[model samples]
Target: MDGTFDREHHLIAAAHHLAKALESTTDLNHDTKWLLSDLSAHLSRAIELGKAHRAHNSSTAEIEARLMSAAQTITRLHSNHPKIWDAGHTTISEYLKAVAEVQRLTLSLEDMDLPKTSRELLDRAQNTLHSAMARLEDELAHALIRSKQGFLEHTEYEDSLVSNEDDSVRTGRFSSSESDVGYETDLVHPDSIPHIKSIAGLMFGSGYGREFCWVFTGFWRNVLAEHVAATLGFEQLSIEDVLRMEWELMNSRIRKWRAAVRGIIGTHLVAMKRLFDLVLGKYGDPITSSACLVEASRAPVMRLLNFGLAVSIGPHRPEWLFCLLDMYETLTGLQPEIDALFPDETGPSIRADFHDLLMRLGDSAMAIYRELENHISLCSSTTPLASGGVHPITKYVMNYVTFFVDYGETLERLFRAQDAGPGPNIPDHLRSLTSALEANLNWKSNLYNDRPLKHVFMMNNIHYMVRKVRESPVEQQFGDEWVKAHIGKFRHHATCYERETWGPVLDLLRDDRRVGKSGQKGMCRAFAAAFEGVYKRQTRWWVPDLQLREELKIKATKMVIHAYRDFLGRAGSSVCEKHVKYSEHELGTYILDLLEGSPKSI
Candidate 1:
């Protein structure tokens, strides 16, 4: 096993070895450091011996001394270095080239081709040179491997420092540290012991496997980044050497840290994002001072959500249906006291502020789910992995179903007495939200939709809190009033496509039996969405291309036309006319303009 790579398969083998090492061991920092240092020392000796042998090419006596030194270095390492197997290796194939150059020169100065004294000198030099060259080549190859080992160790140190920060979360039950000097002590369970490992291990496992994953990814990323730099003309390590080093590390280290760290960061990112969502809901817009109240306590649910996302969407992006699994788990742990709107359960409940934000986010996410699902279906129509749109829809909708249906509305009813009965600090926005919920106990993203059922069903998750919120008393649904107001605004925005403009389109969706559906309610309601997208940039007749052409220009216009034509062909003229019927075009449009451009104006 001369240390040189076989060129064809060595790098891959090395990576596997390194990866295995990383996976199998608990920690290499303490025990492995000495091996690295010793490896470095032996490599240095080999290089020095190679150099000395090359320098003594004119005399066998001198060549013998240099060869002996290399032999000792080899013995000190307890074995011949892999250089024997990798016999002709060097930096840039220098050993091969040197051998060829010397052989050619030696041939030119053969004994028969020169004078007696000169011939004798040439013979001795040629013999010594060949032997010295062989020994030097062997040592050079050995030294190269030792150098690589040195590099691998250096990378491990760097990786230990920058490997992703794992904010360890203690989720399982806590246990006492005492061994019971008294009658009783809380015995730590074997299963929980893993959870209570040192903070570092809990966050980013100290085991060999975890460290290996981080180090492997870091080293490979550096190598690739270096390759990118090389492509741009900067000089650095060869992709081959770096790649080889990566393989070696992978083989030795399996990176247990990856699973745990991934678990931790994913939890934090999810909670941070959800907190951001809740703030958007209650505050609408939080200024620096007031927003400080929305603190993340790193709750159990938050950790679970993060772990689910990491395992499902972010880190490994698995094929199994994880969103549903998470949804099921969240539902199984349901409690009675959670007020969906105010959502501050006294014990282990989703925080009030965060719950509020999650509801709004759930509402917003429905819109995104529709859009992204439609996009995926349109783009990947024929592919097998395309399950087409299912992937994108599952991403947000499945993960957040409980937030919208049970959590959001539950809080509203429970807190209604508290909100309306006594608080002078209540904002107008909060009050309006509750009022809207009272009016539409079944209010949702697509309750009015009649087509594709999925659109209505896509966000139709009114199971727990959402149903409760909608069904609650007017005062209980202060937040609903805010929602209704936005819907009103969206509804009015549809005027841009009214009978005068996009009228025929709305008619088809609402009343038309085309697409083979019976009701036009869904289509009639979609006007707000259609007009909002098309007229958002500019509503002027000269600005919106649809304003100029009788035919549509953008995606929104096309959808409207499709809904209208499909409706007109089967459902008839009255279908198109109803697009103008809901709350009057002027009223709806006014509501929309107010919601978007200036709520203060209202």
Candidate 2:
């Protein structure tokens, strides 16, 4: 009361007293609460007095003194709930309500003559409120931690109802007030605290909301930074395990971030980007840049590839490779959306993370291919062909090479800019390995006694390899040139088969002495012998593709028919009436049925 007569004197004493009180009181008390309530009411009265006295042309010092009293009073009130403030029990709405009240007091004096006091009081009130809000921000940050802790496991964390996709599934941490209303009628646990979302909503309302957005984004950046550091710091995990775990974690964060932003309106994009920069920008180190707390993500993606592509050539050849390819594609496909969320102009490009991820994936795939090619080159071809009629190595190679076919467009887009060309030297290595395989097939065919039969084996396998590569995305790597080259080789093999097996029969048909000499029937017996030997032998062999089989059959038939018909017309009935068992026409007809050899003949 003694200091109250001089307004300036009162405000100075109030500030000093309140500051001291706040420093001294570490515990909650009824006395402190009453003192705060009284001070708040007094400030309200002082604001009213100042506004009423303002239009009377009071001195600047006198008016300033009154407003300063109110300002100091509000600042004192901020320290009132020390225990609750320290414990983070102060709700954001409650804090904002107090700020709004103080703001209203400051605004009431807007038309007054006390320019200095009005500005000073308003600044002081706003600053005090900001300090209180800062404390509230700490609470909100803790609430996020609490929400995470409420879930016993990461799976439960995923199941939390705070998802941007589905807001109706109310988890206790984010449920609406309406959903929680029934808690009052039921046996009460602790009074339900405001949900994290409700608190966030209050903090984000209208005036000064932008500042809180910065704070909010900064908080999440720190949170995510810690998450990344923890994920990467798996000291006990194998490098492979560390990589896999980090991949899963990073993927989870990206997905959650994506889902979370779905509910965010376009207006909030700037704030969202700030958060993105904290998590993904190169310079967003948390401790140094808390206001813009961004940390660049260092994903253990290469190790993920190493584990995924560790497949050998024997049995599990491409399955592991396929699984990784799937992951690569999935991550690749999600890039645009995730990138849109966290774009940074001055920092590293938004697309850099995804681009790096894809490049690493390509490198991993190339590494796998190199290992597989080495394995293919060293492994013997003596292993029986797999059940699919392709040799084990051939099947493995085909599968490995074609695994990325579905991702052709993506790869082209990714590597399209490569001035040095697609390296890891994958395409050329694969082509050379394929040629080696062909040579190996030729060498292996020597194991068979019959020349024609050996060529058939070569034809079947080469045809299989060519067909697989032709139909798949492997063509992207191997190219049209490789395809045409292989197809030509297949044609050459078919021609060789005709020459080795059917050449003798056609030659005999054209022999003039064979007409009746030594009772050797002209070309009829020659046709029978050749058909019985070659066609019957082919009948036992398996051709996997029906389309290819038909083509081979047509080619083989055409070669024999023209020559046989010409010979038959030349030799005629003169040869037929002698030692020839069948007429010339009958001989012509028999060669037609060559591919369908009998089981006895076979």
Candidate 3:
């Protein structure tokens, strides 16, 4: 043989050479030399065998075919046990490694010199892998939907009867036939709603439903968050769009959840009424039954309602203002039933939970307004003064106040439910918010240099506030007395504008007894100059609100014109026709036209 030999001869020759090499390395320790020689021979043999296998291996077409077969097997197994594969039974790393292998094979096939038939087989196999992955994800989504649907649909249950030891046993244990009792003899127990049952199961297992309540609420919230992320994609959703979708989802879920709860426990009257009757008949008091119901119901049910309320305010929708109030009422609507059912012993503990639930809902509901205030504050700060309309903050605050006004009674109910005492109630919170906004308006008015223009800004805001309160649902919140107080402020600002803005014209019209010969002429000239200046400046400043503008002008003109008429009458007799510029009627008419002719007001 030249160099290569049969398997047995190769092993024999390699062992002999390693032994000789070990003997030659006498400077080294005996054991070390033997290990080094043996390792070197094995390394050389492995290298030679690797080259030989590469030379003699199957063609690229056969290799591609083998990989395709392996992929097909994986695909078929995955289709058969998609859950097992998806759940990573063989380990996530291994499953992903398989998927990566298939992807690599597909890409490699693109660059390979393969025949059409081979390439087609590989393409189909790769497509199968892709389809399997997609179907697995789709299956998971459908499975979750089905699970929730099952939870909802399974709310109602058939009543089961247990025979007392002394009770008569007939052909059937339970029957529709009437016994001594007026109604049907068979008594039915409530069916187990899945979510409620979940709570009950956890209670028995762990001593309370609090853990289950948290787990259930947290699970659904995570699912909802994932749904939102998936539906809206990686891009950001506008606040309005997010809030609209959140409201839609919350409203839809709340209705369904409420119905589910009602189906399980029945309405307050039907459920609690029947429960009370049963407890009184059996135990002589509802204290124990009520306690049981409270323990099971409070945590899970409140958690369910609160989860929706919390999520609804995620984007802080203003429309939810009334909805939240309504929800708060709905949540606490059970008070009367609780009192009637367990009035003596269990009432306080049960009612305490209801109180807490109301507090949570109120805090969540008010949180949206707080968010709006922050947004309005930011908008007011960044917005430019030149882009004048109503300031955005003003409009938003007005809307908030208007909303509170419309629902004042409902808010009062909420506060009273929380045990807030008589004086300075829920409206006080709203009053403080409005006061802060008014202060902000006052600061913004300082941006104007013209004193009267600044007063005009304050006048417009104060007028708007007073008018809105006087006419809106909020009218009830502020009361007639408070409203009149605001109206007084509105009038004060308007009168201040008149007194300050036209002070120069009024000063010119004041008679001076000192000047003699041409005194009337000099006074007429000075009066003409001052009056013309007032008209020009006032005309350039606009009052956009026609009614308020007309009102302001009517009052200002009444004051100035009355003073002007007296001065002109005294001067008209002393001065020549050439020196007298305006009659009393003409000056009065010009004063009236000043507001009408002014540039558009902010």
Candidate 4:
């Protein structure tokens, strides 16, 4: 066939050359010109025959028949039954081969007019290719859906967020090796990737790239939403929902949201991006893969972010401050992962949204923290505690401030970021808050009518505050000096309480030269009455700290017992037994029973 075609091409060229020579020669006769014209017409006919021969051949007929058969197979598999996956490997292979052949024919016949039969065959090939592509599209989606790894378990996410005490935020950088390991566990199954790539390549090459991307992105988007909502237990929360949610419930959800953010951005979205690249990278269009990934992940990512945003913009209550800090820290921790996952055309917008949420949370947290001073200063009790024990406000403020100790570093960062100039740090703010609480406590102590009870109230509250600061991380914030200083303040209050309540009682035991026999009896009665009254009144005053209570009891007992014994030695011979209402041993016992927080009478 090659030799015959070459011979025909040579004959035509030779005849054309001879005719051109005959026409150019002026000496040539009319007969020669007539012969040249006939030769030209024959050459044109031969050229037409050559074009027809090239356009239609034995191989072309066979290819058309194969395409028709392949189209029939595809139509049968997809039309009524739609069991493309049930087809044998040979059937699939033949269908793919037929599509390849159609591509070749289309390329070869480009820009050339085709005969009716050839055109019809090409048209049938196109229809068959479309059916095959449609089936492949379904297969791609099915494979993706079937092979997708399950959502990262909520426990797994929670565990990831749990870090050492030093690493309160768990901002550990993800190593490539670690990410690859995680991706392997969460991405599309290895076996499904090649099949996906094959389908994606064919569809993209066949002018169905947009359709392929649409299916991929749409499926993953819905899958992501389902996994977030149903599997991971994160729902889209509007600002109103967040604002109205009770703290206990909102707190639980915030924890879940933190975990979900880590799981989705750190694990799931990363896996999705890897799967997209693996399936579509074969076509070597990174933009399409990235765009698809962004499209698939944006809604779910924003859904998670919207929850954070809602929480951030909600009321900055002190109770919600820690949870807000938790949210801020969670996003701060996941920033690296977010940057890596969304580094594309749309990355900036997503990153900006995330950053905005972080800022809002930080701002909210700082607002709550800064308001602590006002909260403490405003916390007051019109009715003093009758027992003079630790005040309710004292417990609340101390515990609240102590909680900030754990988030000291986070608070420092937030404060520094929010600060435009030099301002109070965490310690300063906490100290100020403590000062406000102490001032409020002073005002509350005045509510007590008895002077001694006022001292007891201050002693109890100040001592409790000092102990809390010493025992908790709040100590680190306030320092040893602050603890010592507060310790001194409580001790001072204890001294004043002893002086005011027991000083006059001790004075009654002083020996007097002017005491006659009746004077001795009267003095004894006065001392006994004062002792009983003081003991009975103080027993009602509560010393919540066991060590402090024991110390105060021992001191008071020693002071009263020493004085009473001395006075008894000096006046025992003068006073009557009835006038000495109590013995030294009994008197000491009564003194030791004071400050037990239960009222008693002798």
Candidate 5:
């Protein structure tokens, strides 16, 4: 049966039709510009709505295809108009590829019963998309550097300007048609400077006052904000907060950039004028390039710095800048370093395997939280951080863990769906996700720090308890039924780890306490250091040195090892939160005993 066009696909087809129509017509009519822009917007809404609906792979593929087709049309226009080359190019081939990469990796693919041919066909689809994007970037980058007329014959753009660019504005490099505009081709803000060039396209020699605001309001603002939220592991943020932080930075960036361009034009008019036209002559009008997509985060980073750095960049700005530079270098450089993580599927990276595990443990905890978060506060009214209160972040952390675990499960489900063929199965997908939870839990217990999981358990318990009291007081307001059952599930889950993983460690800490050993303080310091990290607190380091951080790290490592050694001797299979209760008598007494220098060994 033919795959029928869904709502999103229909929208995409309409958008592409509009793009094709505009791409072919050189006269540039308001109806076409407005129509194409509206379609672009409709495509955006379709993508957004589709994501909200968990649209099928075909749906996404269709949208990407339409966008790519639009990209191709715009690429042709680049020869005639150079500024569109930057903005349109990134939106299409390069940036879309990265977005597709994320979307593709999320599918579950294990246990699929697909015929070999079907499997190969799926892989070929991915390869085709990836290869086309790669080719497009290389082609556009070279095309950008070449000298050209109204456009190189093969190049194109639908004039992705707010108002249409006049073809006369682009005279051949050989003739002195219009005064050469001077500008910096610094690649400093490649993502942004293109729109400013659109303004130069005006028939009256007037530019769009802020053409970039179109991209900002319409595209990168949403993408970057989404990226920030995903990276930071936030599920929800207040609209006010987002506007104050994310939107403010974006607006600030535009303000700075416009003013900078105006300043450059005023101070170095001849150079700026020539540089502007030179850019137009070479790059043409197109959307997307690997080079540009790689630099997608740069404009945002610079924007972040312009707003954030002013607060503290004065003292050691160079070091911070080096960090930023290093980040870019690693992301672009290491992207090609890994092939796959697991041996059988040959998908995911070694790091992805680890991320999967973390996700699993994170989710299991959150599943329990969903049932228990509100009512836990009733059992104890105390928060995590208030002198002895907990943090709200623990809830998010657990949920984020759930998300990662779900990512793993989603991958597994993909394999299953592949095997089943025809209909995609979701329940199988969820199972694939939770499979990583147990393994991830074990991995953390065996972290390089080598401390006992009891230490972590204690920290989590404290944080979880705190989160209940402070943020989720709703349970306190209601009678607890499902909450108790929820806590029961966590207790049952905890029993699964009742083995000697942290038992020896717990015993060691207990013995050190019994004889009044001095290791307790050192241990707490190390644990504090791990939880808070070096940035916030004057904490111990995992590995320290007198060169400052190195010395501190060494001391911290010793302290942690000492604590671990003591705990290892005493930790046992009986180790559970039920057996463990911390109060002034049990925990404080032990620490006090250790300080008195009783028996040293656990």
Candidate 6:
């Protein structure tokens, strides 16, 4: 038997040497070269098969010895330097090669009906593979932990990624470009990925794929949790926590939650999916990679989504509406990415939860929007603003609706879906809201005892509403026609103001033929009393808008000044200088001072 083996080995060695010689030869015809090349290839292949067959037929004792040696090498290498699989370590290749050989021998033994000695050798090989996989799992965890990129500090994240606007405007501007969101750095060190993949492949091939997934997914779950908490300042909150938490604190956390969602979905999870593909795609199949990615990312992402869900289901306070809208807009914007990243069995559930959350938020936002109109309609004031300036509810509602301008397109889509009436639109909603506010203002204006001051109050508020719409993007939603219509409303209020306040004073100056020459002085006295009274009272009234204040002043002057000049000319011949109080120019000057917001007593 020994002699036969020796002759076979010698024959294979001679064939390999001759094949090498023939491969290097060049001086031959085309047919001769082709025949020689084919013979050389066949001879090389036969030599490889002979060597493999000889190894396979070798003694079980020799195979056992080889397995023991490899096992010892793996154990010694791992024991000596536990982190040999770390990114920069050079010894990891040697360790991995030994484990790979153990896996090969163990897999080869599985197909054979081994004798007692060969079975023992197979058991040793399997044990070595198991130990190697266990060590590799530790190495994978360590490599992931050591190579993870540091999270951005909260302040730095806010400065770089979050907007500085107030919550309402911040939410309104939820649309983000790909470049605007996400981390620029890799999640794990690029150099470490190959080692991770190598470890993963070996473990997967050795039937430790489930264990490998556990290590990978568990480590990443913690990493993402840390990033969400440490960097983005988001924490998992139960529905009760959301409901019971103070709105001030809750609002702050909601903002942080938004930042967390953007960072995780847009940057960290994207990097994580790529890393999963890099590490596990080749060895564990696409399904396994996708499953691991979903497992790792689901908890962290759900932590964010759950908060939004809580807010969506919570009380529909008017103050919370914008944040809700912001959350809704953010999720709506990220739906495509969410769907793409999680495409496994859990993906449908996640997508369903995500869609359900969006629907709830939209429903909540619509409820709050409707609540705003109701609040405005029901709003009442027992005491009027003595200055006849803008009402508190007017400022609140207009400023509230003005923030919606930034969310105009988003709100338009939402309103269209939520509005059940035929042809329901954003402009109509805005117009309805403004009408509620107007009705509220009209009711509140009755609190004023002076009728003309009521007109002043209406004029001031209507002008303010128009100015707010004109100054914001809401003008587009409301359209120029709506703005023009409101402009006409305020101007009509202005006309009524002039008629009520100044018209009586001007009527007092009309030439009366019924007045005898002796009675002209008494008429002059009455004019002085009426003019001074109008000046003292109306000067004390306020118009906060500069443009409207000046316009009212100009028109008042034109009406009163011309009327007084004519009255003085007709009554000057009979009246004494004492009754003629002052010149027409002084009256015009004083009229200009009316509606300056500051009260001046004459």
Query: Which candidate ranks first by TM-score, i.e. highest?
Result: 4
Q: What is the C-alpha lDDT of each candidate?
A: 0.32, 0.49, 0.52, 0.75, 0.33, 0.76
| Per-residue accuracy of model 5 over 1-602 as CA lDDT, tens digit each | 22343565666767766676775676988787777777766676776665544444555456456544544543454444443344555543444344244224323221333445346534544444444344334433333343221111111111111111221111111123112222223322454344334322321121221232233222323444443333323234333443344422433332333232222222232222233333343342332221222223333323332322232222221112222222222222222322111222322333353334223323332333233323222223222221111123333223322232223333343334336344323333323222233233333334324232233233333334223322333334212643454355444433332223323333445544453333544444444333233222111111111232233234334543455545544544233222333332333323322211123221
Q: Rank the candidates by TM-score, best first.
A: 4, 6, 2, 3, 1, 5
lDDT of 2 by residue, 409-441 (tens): 544544544443653345775687787777777
* Candidate 6 lDDT by residue in tens digits, 147-200: 777754332122111222232233334333435355555878787778778888
TM-score of 1: 0.18
> Each model's RMSD to truth, in Å?
30.7, 18.0, 26.1, 6.2, 34.1, 11.6
Deviation from native of the Cα of residue 359 in model 3, angstroms? 11
Model 3 over residues 267-288: C-alpha lDDT tens digits?
3223433532442223323354
- Our tally of clashes for model 6 stands at 0
Compared with the true structure, the alpha-carbon lDDT of candidate 5 equals: 0.33
The residue ranges of model 6 lying beyond 4 angstroms of the native Cα positions read 1-58, 86-89, 106-128, 150-171, 175-185, 231-234, 244-255, 283-286, 318-322, 369-375, 396-423, 472-485, 504-540, 558-593, 599-602
Q: Ten-residue segment with the worst summed lDDT in candidate 2?
A: 181-190
TM-score of each: 0.18, 0.42, 0.41, 0.78, 0.17, 0.75
Sort the predicted structures by lDDT, highest score first.
6, 4, 3, 2, 5, 1
Candidate 1 at 344: error in angstroms?
A: 63
Clash pairs, candidate 6, are: none
Local error of candidate 2 at residue 512 (angstroms)? 6.1
**Candidate 3, after superposition: displacement of residue 209 in Å?**
36
Query: Model 4 over residues 305-413: C-alpha lDDT tens digits?
Result: 8888888888876667767777787788778778777775757778889888888888888888778688778876688888998887787677666676668678768
